[model samples]
Target chain A: MTEKVSIKRKVKCALLNILMYISCAVICLMLAGIAGYIIYRGAGGVTVDLIVNKPSLLKGTIGILPNILNTLYIIIMTLAISLPLGVGSAIYLNEYAKNKRVVRLIELATETLSGIPSIIYGLVGMLLFVQLFKLETSLIAGSLTLAIMTLPTIIRTTQESLKTVPGGYREGSLALGAGKWYMIRTTVLPSCIDGVVTGCILSIGRIVGESAALLFTAGMANEVLGIFEFFKPKMSGSSLTVALYMYAKERGEFEIAFAIALILLALTFIINALSKLAAAKLKGKGSGR
Target chain B: MKRAANFLEKAMNVIFTFCGFIAIAFVVLVTVFLLVSGIPAIKEIGIFNFLFGRVWASTAQSPSYGILPFILTSVYGTVGAVLIGVPLGLLCAIFTAKMAPKGLGTVIRNAVDLLSGIPSVVYGLIGMILIVPFVREAFNLPDGANLFSAIIVLAVMILPTVISVSETAIRSVPREYEEASLALGATKTETVFKIIVPAAKSGILTGIVLGIGRSIGEAMAVMMVSGNVANMPSLFKSVRFLTTAVASEMSYSSGLQRQALFSVALVLFVFILIINLILNLVVKKDVK
Candidate 1:
């Protein structure tokens, strides 16, 4: 009876181990398959012409220069607005806010904001920015929407890094008679700058990956727009993700879509690496301190 | 100099206080806008008909605005994704947190990060090119873009969230639990499965909830693969999710149709809010 039970247990253990191995293999293989297939299919379509020139119907040329510019403009605009608000909120939460109830309320609000999906953001942005504010389906409106969406990410990261900053630093600055704001500005903020940087990189990743939010708020007009044009009302421009959607879904231009996907994949890779590095640096700093 | 410094401090305090309230303001603004815009349509359409009506022809001559199909599709798709994703993700998390060597674990972790960072549009593009056609051929169906393909795509999309969260949970299980199980003559696999995983149950459940939120909220990828049609969902039929329903027709839709789209969004928002509450509860319980 003991021998029989041992054989059954051994079979169970072996089967379970195999299942775990297979699951890991499946996940790794899926990642490999996606990255490999995209590179194989998309590498050929990525060329100088595709990157540099604007898509012209008269000339029958396909390019993503405008989409690229739009993406850059949106990123700059979003970061400019969200960074201050996010960092400020983090500072207030970590440094200034004394009332735990108020802090909890703000934290819960941000959590709810993060939980809300981008499509809802798109809808609200359309209502608030485009209609009520009369920004009129422009990149500016899209950036405003995205700034709100990314606020939670920035605030959470900054607050985390702020928490890691030794309380001694603040107390020491106070002992030297430094003002509260001055102490935070000169000492606390600089130490936790890595967290802010990580948050910035992560927000960029979200902006780059974003599409559904921008679709309605930022109209998908693939035209090369100057910097000034980005601010003008009704100046619609499609980012690369939106462009990829238009190409694949609307135009059936698989080659162009694949090329855009490849570019996005590359961007995702770079952003992931940069953020990982930032996180590692933050960790190293935390331990060193 | 003292006066200037004092004034600067007060000014900065006000600025930071205002900034801190910005998140609260934005949340209130979003809720107000969604409610203001979304209510008009629901009132016009009547609540029961809008929620439970089967047919949805927004552009038809008479124009029925029922969203039963979309809600059902969204529910079915999320459930399907969770069913496939949770087990696979849990197993992978266990492997990463316990079974794999440090080097292999790092590789898997990076891969998961990369997967999460990849844009939904790229996933859509790939699904359009690969999975759609493959589904068609495999099932001998007339159209490949259907609920099944969408579910497959969603399952993959939620993998990173599930794996990372569950891995963290599994890792946080006290070392003594595993050591004690091992000392009791149980095999390593047995200890991990029977002892460690059960201890990490709350975390794993939290990951599952998060995965549900992601799957339900996904729009672009589902929009690309799921043939944009208002149909009662089945495994083989092309159907539209709540997100896709709003996205597919938002461009040219106007009048009541446009308002109805906002209503759909409102419903989606409510679902997300419920998920968020559940997430908070789960997290709070875990803390305790």
Candidate 2:
């Protein structure tokens, strides 16, 4: 009987061990397969002409220059608006807020904002920015919508880093006759720069990956626009992700879509590496202190 | 110089306070706008018909505005994704937290991060090229773009969240429990399964809730693989989710059709709010 019980235990343990090994293998293989397939299919379609010139009917040539430019513009516009607002909110919550109830409410609101989906952001952006605010279906409208969406990411990261700042630093600055804002600007903010950078990289990843949010607010007009033209209320443009949707789903142009996917995959890789590096640096600092 | 510094401090405090209120203001704005735009259509269609009606042909001559199909599809797809994703993710988390060596664990964690960072559109593109055709040929169905493919895509998309969150939870289980279990002559596997897992249960539940939120909100990927039809959902049937229903038609929809899409969004929002509340409760319990 004891021998039989021992055998049963061995069988159960072996079964669980096999399951774990299989699960890990499945995850690793999925990533490798997806990345390998995309590179194999998409590498041949990427070219200088595709990256530099706009699509032309006369030449029968396709290009993504307009979409690329629009992506850059939206990224810049979104960061410009959100960075200050997000960082300020974090500072207030971490440094200045006295009431615990108020802090909890703001944190709850931020959590709710993060939980709301991008599609809902798109709908609200259409109603508020595009129609009520009269920005129309322009890049500006899309940027504003994304600004709100990314706020939670920035605030959460910044608040976490702020928490790690040693209390001695703040108190020391105050003892040396530095005002609260001055102390934060000179000492607190500089030390937590890694967190801010990580926040920025994560937000950029979200903006680049976004499609459903931009589809309605930023209409799919691929005409290349100048810097001045970006601010025009009527100027509508499509980012690379939206363009990918149109090419693959609407136009049956899979080659172009795959090429765009390759670019996005590259961007994702770079963003992931940079954010990881920043987080590691933050950790190193925390331990050193 | 002293007066100027004091004035600067006061001004900066006001500015920061205003910035702090921005999050609350935006949440209020989103709720108000979705409610105002979404209510009229529900009223026009009648609440009962809008929620429970079986048909959703919004562009037909008479234009029925029922969303029962989309609601059912979203529910079914999310549940399907959870069924496939949770077990796989939990197993993977166990490997990372308790089984693997340090170097291999870091490599797996980084891979999971990269998986999470990949764009949704890229997932859709790959699904369109690969999964759709495979499903069609395997099932011998007329069309491969169905709820099954959508669920497959969603399961993959939610894996990173589930694995990462669960791994963190599992790692936080106190070492004392494992030591005591071993002292009692229980094997390592028994200790991990019977003691550690149960202790980490709330954290794992939080991850599952988060994955549900992500899979339910997904639009472009589901739209690409699911063949965007307003049919009652079956395992192999082409279906439209609440998200895809709004996305596929928002551009060309007019009048009541447009308003009804907003109503669909409102319903999705309410579902998300409920999920968020549950997540909060789970997290609070974990903290306690």
Candidate 3:
């Protein structure tokens, strides 16, 4: 009886180990398959011409220069607006807020915002920015929408980093007669730069991958908007993801779609690397503090 | 001079306070806008009919708009994705957190991060070409872009969140518990599944809930693969989720149809709220 029980236990343990190893292999293989297939299929179509020129019916050329630049513009606009609001909120929550209940309420709101899907953000952006604010379906409106969507990410990351900043730094700054805002600016915020960078990278990842929110807020016009043309009437264009959607779904242009996919995959790789570096830096700093 | 300095500080405080209020204000604004825009159609069409009636021929002359198909599709897709994703993700999490060598772990972690960073549309595009065809050939069906294809794509889309969250949870399990189990002659595998995982139950639950939210809210990926028809969900049948139901029509929908799309969004919103509330409870426990 004792021998049989031990054997049964051995079998169960072996099966569990197999389960663990198989799951790991499955995950790793899935990743390998996706990366290999996308690169092989997509890289062939990513030509210099596709990267540099814009589509023109007369010339019959398809390019994504405008989409790439528009992506940068949206990134700049979203970060400009959301970073301040999110960081300030984080500061208020972690450093300055007097009422615990108010802090909890704000935290809950931000959590809800993080979980709310981008489609709803798209609709709200359409209603609020495009219609109510009278901004057309332009990059400006799209950026504002993305800014709202990314706020929770920035705030949460910043709050986390703020929490890691030692209390001694703030108390020391205060002991030297620094005011609250001054102490935060000089002492608290500096240590949390890596957290802010991580947040920015995460938000950029979301923005780069985003399509549903921008579709309604930023109409799919592929023309490049100049500096002066921004915030003017009808300065609308597709980002790379949205362009990929239009190419594959609307235009039946698989070559161009694959080209865009290749670019996006590269961007994803870069962003993931940067975020990991930022996270590692944060960990090192956090432990030292 | 001192009064002026104090006044400046107070003004700065007020500005930061206003900035902090911005998030709460946006939430209120979205909820109010969704309610204001979404209710009129429900009142016009009757709530019961809108939520539960079977057919959804929006462009037909008669134009019946029951969303039973969409709601069920969303629910079933989320459930299916969770069923496939959770176990695979849990095992992978255990491997990464406790078993893998340091070098292998970093590589696997990076791969998972890359998978997470890929855009939903890219996933959709790949699925449209690859999985759709594979499904068609495997099932010997005329079309392969059905609920099943969408579920597969969603499962992959959700893997990173599951793996990352559960890995964190499992890693945080007290080492002492595992040590005690091993001291008593329990195998490492038994100590992990039977002891460590049970201790991290709440965290793993939160991760699964987060995946459900993601699967239900996914639009572009599901849209590309799932045939954009309002059919009740079956494993092999083409179906439209609530998200796709709104997205496929929102671009050119007019008058009552447009309002009805908002109503669809409202339903999706409520489903998300319930999920968010549960997620909050789980995460709150983890924090404590």
Scoring only the second chain, what is candidate 1's TM-score?
0.99
lDDT (C-alpha) at residue A265 in model 2: 92
Residue range A1-289, candidate 1, lDDT tens digits: 2323387888999998899899889999998999999999899999999999899989999899999999999999999999999999999999999999999999999999988888889889988999999999999999999999999999999999999999999999999999999999999999999999999999999999999999999889989998788878789999999999999999999998999999999999999999999999999988997
* Whole-model Cα lDDT of every candidate shown, in order: 0.94, 0.94, 0.91
Report the error of model 2 at residue B87, Å. Answer: 0.6
Q: Candidate 3 at residue A157, lDDT? A: 95
lDDT of 2 by residue, A12-123 (tens): 9889989998999899999999999889888988999999988989988789999999999999999999999999999999999999999999999999999998999999
List the candidate 2 regions with Cα displacement exceeding 4 Å.
A1-5
The best candidate by DockQ is 1
Docking class of 1: medium
Among the numbered candidates, top lDDT falls to: 1
lDDT of 1 by residue, B125-194 (tens): 8899899999999999999999999999999999999999999999999999999998778888999999
RMSD to the native, candidate 2? 1.5
* Pairs in steric clash, model 2: none
Order the numbered candidates by DockQ, best leading: 1, 2, 3
Superposed model 3: Cα runs more than 4 Å off: A1-5, B286-288
Docking class of 2: medium
Question: In model 3, what lDDT does residue B44 have?
Answer: 96
Order of the predicted models by lDDT, top scorer first: 1, 2, 3
